[model samples]
Every structure is written in structure tokens, then in C-alpha cells.
Target: MSVIGQAEGIEHGTVRGYKQHRYRQIPACDACKKALRDDRAAARRGERPERAKPQRTSRRKAAEELDAATEATPVLLPVPPPPQLPDRPEIGVPIEGADLEIGDVIVFLGNHHRIDRFEPYTGSLRAELGEGTRVACAGTWGMTVGPTSTVRILPRPRRDAR
Candidate 1:
């Protein structure tokens, strides 16, 4: 008998089969075998048979509605500019506990000079105020000019000076 008729034959009690039989060993018809295989594949892939998705509105109609809604909305005003920053001081420099370097400009005795060199061993700095005037200022340690001296290192002159 054909395999397709085996299930019918078993159901009708007309076929004599072995007493010990594995269900997997039983041959199935084409359609039943296809369904069993599909179910097993879905299980192995960690998925279930999905149902058909619901229909959605047309893309053109949805886009037209969105455009109409946006056009009907009011136009928003531009954001205001941020607050202005405060102006900084013209002249201010800290002299205490500072490290002096070559090319540093210092205001001393109503004159400005570029530092030519620093003598740490003698605690002095050599600078040129202008032509024909190069002097050694004492107490250069920690960049302190002197107890009475108001000398300070200027980062740069005022922009108006240029």
C-alpha cells in the first residue's frame, strides 16, 4: 500500500504494524509532511508562524494631511540673542609666587622692559628698559621685584597703544 493510505489503513484497523514503532518513522502524506517540516523549522529558528499584517493608509494621502496641518500652524518668532559679556579690566597682574621667564615684559619705576635673562643663583633679573639702559633688579626670587617696588609683568600693552 502507498504511504498516503497508511494513516487511513491504521485508522480503519486494516493494517498490521509492528508492536514497537517510533511515530517519527511513520511516513506521512506530502501535505502533512510539509506542515510538520514547517512547524519544526519554526521551532528550531525560535519563531512562530506570523499572521497577516493589517492594511495601512496610502502614503500619498498621509503626507498630504501632514503638510496641510503644518501649513495651518502659526509661525514662531526667532529666539532672542544671549546677554552681552562684561568688559574686563585694562591693567592688572599678580606678582606674588610667580615664575619669571625670558622675554617677559615688566613695568618698573615708570618704565617697561623686556626681561633678557634670569639669574636664580644671585636672585636678580637683567632687563633692558630702552637703549643705553640695561640694569639688574634684585629680589627676583618668586618673581617679586621688591618690597617697595610696584613692578608687575604685563601680558600685553593696551590695544589703543598700538
Candidate 2:
């Protein structure tokens, strides 16, 4: 495919031509993309290589030019400070793993379990779901290994996650 297309005399090898292609819903060619990239690279370096250059400059002349350029800079206005945002309350409440009280509903095995008997010292709890089904947890955590826990001692912790 021709990278520099000449369908409508749009000059498709340049950055301006690339924008024209986009405005007309046409995919820009590789040459146009390369041209755009080169243009941006030149802009970052503050240079226009395609434009005519003075060809030579002495150190003193270059210093004078630099001083002139600095003097030509526009005056900057003072910017106001950012607006202060209103203070917000913290999101979800933090759950203490072993500090859960009896009759407190807890989520275990993705099910709601109301604690029946809880041992504060052992961090153990017995939760009952219904009339007969009961879950005796050895620790406050649903799954524990090396002081790491997978569950929080809260009623429907999984629900809050969703």
C-alpha cells in the first residue's frame, strides 16, 4: 500500500495531512504517522530541522541569541491554590478477629453463621445457622495457617465484598 496517498491532494505524508485523514475517517498511512512522530520529536527539542537554518553561529552570537530569547519570554500569572475538599468519614468498619461477641452473625464457608458460644481466650466460636445445623470454629478465622486468616468475624463479610 502507498504510504503517501494523493487521493484528494491532502498531502498525506505530513502531520497536518494525518489529521485530515482522521477527519475524513480514513486510516493514516505509515509515512503520515512517521511524519507526525518526527514533528512531535522536533517540537520537544525546540528545533525545526525542515525550516531554513542560519548555518553558522559564533559562541558570542549564540549567547546573545540565548539572552534575547530569554527576554522574549511571556510573563506568567500567579495561579490560585486548589479548593479544599470536605472531610469524609471512613468507609467500612474494621473488624477485630477474636473480639467477636456471642450471637454475633459471622460469615463462614460463604454462609451466615450466628455465633452461639464464643471463647475470648481461645478465639473459638460456635455458630448456628438454623434449628439443627451448627458450625464449631476452632478460631475466629474461617481458615487459618501460620497466623494468617482468610475470613473476618463479621456477618456476611462476603456480601460487603460484592
Candidate 3:
């Protein structure tokens, strides 16, 4: 059987060699019949459905161009200052290791302090004649090692580093 006829036969159920039956001739509505015929004709003519067009882009090339455009331009950024420790002393405040030692006269940035006594086993220190309580420093303190040999602490020692 021809393809178009077979297709039409499937839609309307009218086979060429089959005996007539009440169901075979059940008339199809005009619109349905015409649509099936059009589809079959289109299939025979080999007409393809239209496809969506592809998009074009030069983003990467544009970015490279931009980079090249700015390649010769110089950029300036600010540098950050170094971290600093606080001056003076307080009680119940633990300092790592100890930056000060007993007998060390430290001029804190804002005030002056001298560690007259420091006990490593108990992590306690006496500074400023005990005015500064439990002073914290960064290294271990030992006897005979005085402030003259180590860094000093002075609160607001100079106009800078305040």
C-alpha cells in the first residue's frame, strides 16, 4: 500500500482490500480530514520544520581586548600598617610567653612600667612598684635579666604609635 493511502487509511480506517463495515465509513469532520491530508502531503514533499537560529558572541575576545587596553595603565593601592600590642597593664589578663622580664623598666606607650618581680610558675609579675598588676609580656623572665636588656613598654611613649 502507498504511504499516503496507508496514513489516510489509519486516520479514517478505510483499507483498500478490507470488506466494508459500519465503522470504516464513519465520516470524519472536514477540518480533521483536511489536516491529515496536509500532513501526509508535507511528508511526501520532504519539507523540514524550521529550526531556531544560533546566538553569536565574542565575549572572551572582548575581555582580552579590554585587558590589553588597560595593560599599560598603572594602579595604586594603599599599604596596611603592622599590628601593634596594647600598652599598660591589667589584672586577670594573661599575656603569651612574656615580652618583659623582671627588673625591666618598660616605658608603655602611654605610661612607664618596671617589672620588679615576675614568677613564671604562677604567671604573675610586679610592675611600676605593683601599680601595674599581673603585667603580661611575650617571653620568659629570669633573674639578672633586666629591662635594660629587653624591650621597654611606655604608654604613648612618643607622639606616634598612639
Better of 1 and 2 by lDDT: 2
- Of the two candidates 2 and 3, the one with more favorable lDDT, higher being better, is 2
Please list the C-alpha lDDT of all candidates, in the order they appear. 0.41, 0.47, 0.38
lDDT string, candidate 3, 63-148, tens digits: 88668868857644333323333322331111112345454444434344556665433334434224323433334433322222
Better of 1 and 3 by TM-score: 1
Clashes of 3: 21
Tens-digit per-residue lDDT, 1-25, candidate 1:
3342134333211112211011212
What's the best-to-worst order under lDDT? 2, 1, 3
Please give the range of 10 consecutive residues that has the lowest summed lDDT in model 1: 13-22
Ten-residue stretch with the least lDDT total in model 2: 85-94
| lDDT for position 141 in model 3 | 31
lDDT tens per residue, model 2, 38-145: 987987998854433345899999999879978897645444323433312121122334344455555554555556563323323323222222233444543221
What does the lDDT read for residue 117 in candidate 2?
63
Task: State the lDDT at 118 in candidate 2.
Answer: 36
Highest lDDT against the true fold, candidate:
2
Top model number, TM-score: 2
Candidate 1 lDDT (Cα, whole model)?
Answer: 0.41
